[model samples]
Target: MENMLVTRFGHAAVLVETEDARVLLDPGVFSVDEVFELERLDAIVVTHQHPDHLDRSRADALLARNRGALLLADPQTVEQLGAPWRAHRDGDRATFGSTTIAAVGELHAEIAPQLPRVSNVGVLVRSETGPTIFHPGDSYATVPADVDVLALPLSAPWAKVSETIAFAQQVAPAIAFPIHDRTISDAAYDIYWNHVANFGGVADLRRLGQTEATQV
Candidate 1:
């Protein structure tokens, strides 16, 4: 099998490339401007409707650039975004070139009891010639089997260090890396990464620099 290459465009946005496919995950507001310049994507996946995870302002242009890419989003996002985006609910699977994407989980993590809950889905992406990676959008509820690389969420209003450690331990991925971290400062990142490194229980924990690609 060929290796899979993953590039982080900041926060939760990632460009995952395999031998036969190139897929972008969560091209959100926090993502770098370079995300819009990417081309030849086999698919664009949005885990939820949150602007931080799906930038509505740049969505049109990005779609225009990758006109052949499949657009997949959570149920509510599909309802909100309308045409061209298909709802990828829990248990639903889609194939893009040689890559297979499976949607898992349903609701975003609770921010507060007063806030309305929105739909969310964690995606599991695998290719016949590459590693299996899991990107858990905003929730740590679904723990898929046989995950090689985990795109772990490092910070959020709805996340805690303890919970982050627990989630990584539960998934037990061979390798893990941080995502959803644009909100915190560099000092805070050091603190959080320290804790996860000590207790996340994964064999390897990688810190991906913005816009840099790493092969697995």
Candidate 2:
């Protein structure tokens, strides 16, 4: 994201600076200590209604602080936010500042009997670098199958190594990483390593994290 002047702010939150302005994604509430330090924002793109991924407090903070942020979200999320948000559906396309964004659909988890109502969406961020990064919300990791940088789930409820491998194999990104694993055990990381190293045609996994950004 060097050319796009992007930076990671922990969990799924990220800030992208195009030629015109900055855009925030997810902006998890925890990100307040780190990312919310920024004084201004051009817009916000929300993935779903999950608290960790879409904290109302954070948006409210942005509104109170920046006040100029334009919000984009899936329909259900749009309604839930209660703040005026431009709705974005799967396959819908739009641009934020100079950054081009595509909203895509994703499964919340490997099908569950009781939690079908929760909705999720993935984001394909197109930089002048062009489709360099993709965030698969808090999803099952099969969202964007062939982007430059694919961010998949490594440790969340129902997210096993098998599912991650399947997604890596399918997405086949040049470099891939995982998210939603804040409280997971070390075993999950081991699985992620083995799969990316051995799985044929899987993405060349890099495993970027929330720590001060470092290239793996």
Candidate 3:
């Protein structure tokens, strides 16, 4: 079994590569040109329908390039693609060979539901990677009690330092990685230590910046 290699492409975009194939999530900021190194993806898993999460035009272009590849996403994302795609709901699992990915429903933007917005979801990817990783897309809180590696969304529109810290304290993952952060801030760094850091306890809290990669 090979470790699941994740290459953060800034924003919510990430390229998760396994030995069998590569899968991308929420790649919106840069053009496909920037991801020249990411080649021949087997699937592209999307979390929601937000522009920042999915570039409609870029996704259509890439979908054409890898037309045969699986484009598994929420209903809105699949509807936007206007192509043959797999729409995943909560508890739905996609198994490719020995790999497995589970879709868990989530709240969108932590805002009022009456705002007439679409749905959101979190992804629990469990392969032969270092651990079962959870990328909570843009969600600031979740119900799952256990997490191995948490790719937490920080510095979002509605997320405060207090909410993020409280979330981490509740889940208490084995390791926590800061994500969805537009820019690194000292204040945000302080929030992690003052709140999420389990140095005195057990969890290994890690912060993966725009360019860093954790060796699995």
Candidate 4:
């Protein structure tokens, strides 16, 4: 569907588009620098406050350019980022033109016992007559229902390959793509990609490179 365009900007940054709305998710530090250059945006969704998950400068640039764009995030992120945002916790839903976003998940995955756990809310975005996609931020929690596409985080401080595989197996979406993957080198990233591609996966594994969009 023309409205269901999903572009991966590396790491966890994703740009989701509909006929009437354009939503950017997690314009983090590791995300492509071009995210700051977006001309039009309907909303920006920050799953958490981590620098690698929420880059304030890019967000500022985007919001500054599109004054009416909404910034949606969890309470902690809205508080920590100190930006004008709407509090979107689990079960809360909002509409942006022709698209709808449903908040999901809660806390981020644990980095360590000594480290503090932060709030992270996954989002389910659905556009008019297009695919429904879920971006789960830094968590491995499964969505309650299967989706058309899933942004699967393949690497992070708080998860393992086995856990990633298990999460995919559980969610069992029609298509799953890698995200949260800037920490690894190209070769190392390939290893993870190969595993996800070749494993006895329930969902169709897809690797969306930087700035690449695929129809789900």
lDDT of each: 0.91, 0.67, 0.68, 0.83
TM-score for all models, in order of appearance? 0.97, 0.82, 0.82, 0.93
Model 1 spans with C-alpha error above 4 angstroms: none
Between candidates 1 and 4, the lDDT winner: 1
- Residue-pair clashes per candidate: 0, 1, 0, 0
Residue 71 of model 2, lDDT score: 77
Query: Lowest lDDT 10-mer window, candidate 4?
Result: 195-204
| CA shift of 8, model 2, Å | 2.5
Best by lDDT: 1
- Runs of candidate 2 with Cα error greater than 4 angstroms are 29-32, 141-146, 186-188, 200-204, 214-216
| RMSD (CA, Å), each prediction | 1.1, 3.0, 3.2, 1.6
- Ordered from best to worst TM-score, the candidate numbers read 1, 4, 2, 3
lDDT by residue (tens digit), candidate 3, 22-66 = 777776653234443455878778888877777776666677667
Candidate 4: lDDT over CA atoms? 0.83
Check candidate 2 and list the clashing pairs: 145-171
TM-score of 1: 0.97
lDDT at 112, model 1:
93
Candidate 1 residue-wise lDDT at 134 = 98
Residues 158-203 of candidate 2 have per-residue lDDT tens digits of: 6666767777677777766656656456655676566656872543
What candidate 3 gets wrong by more than 4 Å, as runs, is 30-33, 112-114, 128-130, 183-195, 198-202
